[model samples]
Target: MRRLLQKVLDKSQKAPTQDAPGSTASEITPQVMDGVGTGSEAVDNTQAVGTNPIKISSVQRLGFQNASNSCSHRDLGFTGKIAGKWYAVFGDTLWCAPGVKDPAQDLPGFHGMVRDSVSLLTNDPLTVVDLNLNNDSPVKHQLQFVPFNPAWGETNMYGFGGTSLCETDARSGTGAVYYLVNANDAGLIGAGVAKVVVKSGTPTVTQRYDGTKGHWWDAKTTARYGDVAAYRDERSEYIYLLGHPPSTITGWLAASYVYMARVRATDAFDLTKYQYWWGRQQGWKTKVLNVFTPETAVMWGTGQGQISWNAYYGCYVFVHLAIGGGTVHLRTAPAPAGPWSGDVQVYTAAPIDGGLVYAGVAHPYLDASGKTLVVSFTNNNHIEVIKVAFTK
Candidate 1:
């Protein structure tokens, strides 16, 4: 894992000069909004002052069955909203419907890992779903996977690296890092394998020796697990990945850590070019600080972990996981890259799951007022949407 991290850190430094093959750098300008070129100003201008608490309406599910063949929505980790429409990315499926209240039946096509008894082990396909606001979709042109077991989140989505440790296809080995691109000009076929940029990284797909019930896959090659958040802030483009590494000596330890990486707009998607930071535990006091680049410390806590941001806040919210199973609390920062403040109870229930919250995605939206924030997660087979009301 150390070797893998070193390699990725090296690659991230070398920015890609080309957008794609034919696509020029001029075509892919930094994302802009409302006369402003950066996200921060636009977010501040749109914030709802003295706004009411956000109201959440249950939208329909993507209609996928579980391992038991019952109606189940598994691992709805990351979500994105483009052009007023909502999209949820889950394991093996990408679901799309009109609004938060649209019926599940209204959603079209299952994009990945179709169910079949004979091919149970071999057919698992990892997918990421998001609505394309730039284009119109009779069925909503969603991105699909060319490789199997693709690990994705609201921010970063990439193919699993290294070899597969599963007893099923241990022979094929873990695949390389690949990105999906438009297979056809119509944008109907979804994304297909175009290139393999990084090879032999960390986090092989394998069941750990300890009997953890779920798939304990790391987002990157490191010993961390959490969601990834990305957006352009104040002329700087940032990608934040919240990772919780295995804390116990044996395989059963429950403790976790969080870290982040940042890159300038000039940098490419390569992993080496960015700066990194790790969460530290110091004799009952925990601190989240940067490990690479100009060293800096951010937040310190005994509890806070999984972090997400609202462009409206101009900062990231550090969510504290309750001990012995309780409600999650939130803390805010001026930037996703932060010197974070203390905790504030944002929601009484677990943000991701009603029983056990796993992952969440927070995106800023505009309504009748100005900027209103909506946070969504897949909790116990149901996608719960919560409206966050900011206090002055």
Candidate 2:
């Protein structure tokens, strides 16, 4: 990765005018909101009130129904969304309906998982739903037979290291990444196995940033089974990948240590080439341990959010639920793969079984000013969005 970064730096020195189009020059400035309330609040027509006092301006619900007039399964969890469309991955089950749409009061898709050899009707299959939230029609396009398992910890469908959606490169369209999981030889073992499928359109394309040979790479050898987080730098030419190890605990449990890796867009996708950037292990201090407890396990089907790069500190930040408790911790790293610093307590709550707080993705939602960072999550039931302002 260093080699790739150096190569990019060298090219910039040579062709300073070769700017990547659509790259933003503006720095991402985040402001933490004050007086925000915490805990479950009432909802009045999509508005949520809590001790934090932060307002939920909008609400969207998604799920599919069976002909018998029942929800597919209660365990379906959405991990990530791109282009305003949500991707639901299955857990504890092998079958699912992928794309589901929710418009108005109607819910169209069934998002849940089922184990192998189970009947579709009797067994809960992992499914995806396609929803048109704008219209009054809540109908879903179901993609059935998606392979995922909570016991195996394969709950994400985005690209490896959680960088981008499962698609080709938005810039050159020359390379693409697909999400896939493989079971260890032990047969559908722990956390299963997560892998990224890489395809290069250009066979002999030299690294534009660095003059390195290019070839396809897999996440198994490259990224592995950690939480994948990504951010587009100000230049946008650099897309950083934060690969943390798989959660140690399973089924609503947490682990002690979290490790990360950083990969660049121009860099080839190989584990040997990837750099170990940052990590967090249990600390000795009570305050630190309280903030970085390895005790809580993320909900059975939630996906870690994309890490937002903080150029000011040369670190990245994302929200994670502390182990054994439902508190959300704001963890930071000096780099995507890091010797990290700062395990600040952000929000706290007791575990709410099958509640909205524990079931959704944690994504950074910028406010109207683009100055305040709003972090949001959704469980199967409700959605919660919080405004975070940094004092520094």
The local distance difference test score of each candidate is 0.29, 0.30
Residue by residue across 228-257, what tens digits does model 2's lDDT show?
344434334444443322322223322223
Best by lDDT: 2
Residue 102, model 2: Cα distance from true site in angstroms: 6.3
Candidate closest to the true structure, highest TM-score: 2
TM-score per candidate, chains pooled = 0.42, 0.43
Question: Residue 174 of model 1: what lDDT?
Answer: 26
Candidate 1, which segments miss by more than 4 Å at Cα? 1-72, 80-88, 92-146, 149-235, 246-254, 278-315, 318-328, 350-355, 367-371
Q: For candidate 1, what is the lDDT?
A: 0.29
